[model samples]
Target: MGTWDSLHKQHVDVFIRINLLEKALLGLLQNRATGDMKGAASLQKDFLKAFEQGMILHFAVEEEALFPVLARAGEKPRILISELLAEHKSIMEKHNMIVQTAAVDKDKILLELIRELADHAKKEEQSIPSIISQLTPEQLNNIDQDAKRLGYRL
Candidate 1:
């Protein structure tokens, strides 16, 4: 594949994984919210695994690799990148809370985390295409390799 096509594929892969995780989290939230803890633990386990395996990597790629590209794009993009980073911090905090707490009704916090992550993903979807287009072929390859090192399938 050509450079732009390859870059777009890798970038889109991250979004696809994020969307899957969000869907799983939302299902878990619905089950937990209903007080139906039957398979909730299993769902929780899977969701947690996905978060550990996927979401963290996505965050690192965006912050470490992609955000710098956006930052150089100018003031408005830099500001948006800053906002997205701040959202990641908050979402991570909630994720930590969800992982550490065994208390009942923690699905509430999981729901909150899902909402925060979904919003973050939407903001990224809006800005990432522009950022990707601005990157050089070498830069995109570096990003793809970095993301792979972080355990991204793409």
Candidate 2:
């Protein structure tokens, strides 16, 4: 697959994963409210695992494949890449907070994180692929290779 295609597929995967996470977070909230501590903890474990593997790795792959190229692009693209990078950092911080927080506090933070991610995804879907489309074929091939090397199977 070409760079844009691989990245697009990954974006779709992340979106689906986000939807699943929303469901899991909602379940966690319901569990906590009903005094089902065991259930809540179990769901928390699952959510954490998925978030780390799915979202964190997705961010890593994007950084590896796109950031350097975007950095070399024109002024507007450079600025936009910085914003995306900042969002990734913010999301990671929130993920860390969710890990350390109490159950009662966790759901609220998770909800915020989910909403932030949903918005972030929308931003990327609007911008990144078009920037990527401007790359040469060789550059596109290299990006796909880099993403695969980083363990993002297309």
Candidate 3:
């Protein structure tokens, strides 16, 4: 076989991380908050703490590295990248809300967070093919390194 030019390491890495986040969200969302209310609240709070930590790096790399490349590529791409950047901001805001919500309102906040994140991630997944096609392996590698520097693994 010839050299495998389609070596998309960064895309694969990001996808792995995204899949992990999706799994965690699915578990948290499917379980629903119940039984010992305090226990549920504590569980979600802990899960969210970890999730937020991971997403900070994830969002940074996308915004700081990936989006800029896409933004400069073309007008339609710039528009889409801007929308994604906005979504990143929105997701962070919602994440903060989830973290700050009172115990009594925790479940509702989690549900909303879940929905918003699901939508954001779905859009990202849909855009991945275009991104991979548009960006060179080296550029993606730079974004991947940036993500790693910000503490993302997988």
Candidate 4:
């Protein structure tokens, strides 16, 4: 099978992660803090922990497996990948801050991170298919193989 065919599963995994994060964000937004600061903080902490774990794996699969191949394809793909990498960096920094900051600061940063991540995912979903369509089956296979080696799972 070609790389895009294999990549569908990985994309599904990423979409799932994004959906979960979005759901978590929705929950946090719906939650009313009736002076239960500890409870609010607890929810934020749980969201952060889950987001960090999933994003680490998500970014790894893209950065290590997919980006390099796309970058080499041409200037457009390279530029796009560069932007995505920058977003990844920013997301990580925000994620780290959320973990370390006080409860008062956590919610703002967490919301920002999730919004940024959702935008990033949208860009990937919109752009990557066209870029990958230009690649050879061998190139696609390489990305698929690399992702598998890095423990990408559906």
lDDT of each: 0.69, 0.76, 0.60, 0.75
RMSD of 3: 6.3
Across 1-154, the per-residue lDDT of candidate 1 in tens digits comes to: 3333443554465456555555555667555436545455566666668778767866786777667766887788889888988999999999988778786767778767766776676677677677778777787777667666765565
lDDT of 2 by residue, 1-154 (tens): 6655665675676677667666666777666445555655565566678777766767887898867787677898999989999999888888888787665677778778877887888898898877877888788777778878888877
Which 10 residues in a row give candidate 3 its minimum summed lDDT? Answer: 1-10
Model 2 CA RMSD to the hidden true structure, in angstroms = 3.2
How many Å off is the CA of 15 in candidate 2? Answer: 3.0
> Which portions of model 2 miss their true places by more than 4 Å?
20-45, 101-103
Cα displacement (angstroms), candidate 4, residue 55, comes to 1.9
How many clashing pairs does model 1 include? Answer: 0
Structural RMSD, model 4: 3.9
Give the range where candidate 1 is weakest over 10 consecutive residues by summed lDDT.
Answer: 1-10
By TM-score, rank the candidates, best first: 2, 4, 1, 3
Q: List the residue pairs that clash in candidate 1.
A: none
Report the lDDT tens digits of candidate 4 across residue range 70-127: 9998998999999999999999999878767676756667778877877887788889
Off by over 4 Å in 4: 1-46
Cα deviation of 23, candidate 3, in Å: 14
* TM-score, one value per model: 0.72, 0.78, 0.65, 0.74
Show the lowest summed lDDT stretch of 10 residues, model 2. 32-41
Given candidate 4, what's the lDDT at residue 149?
87
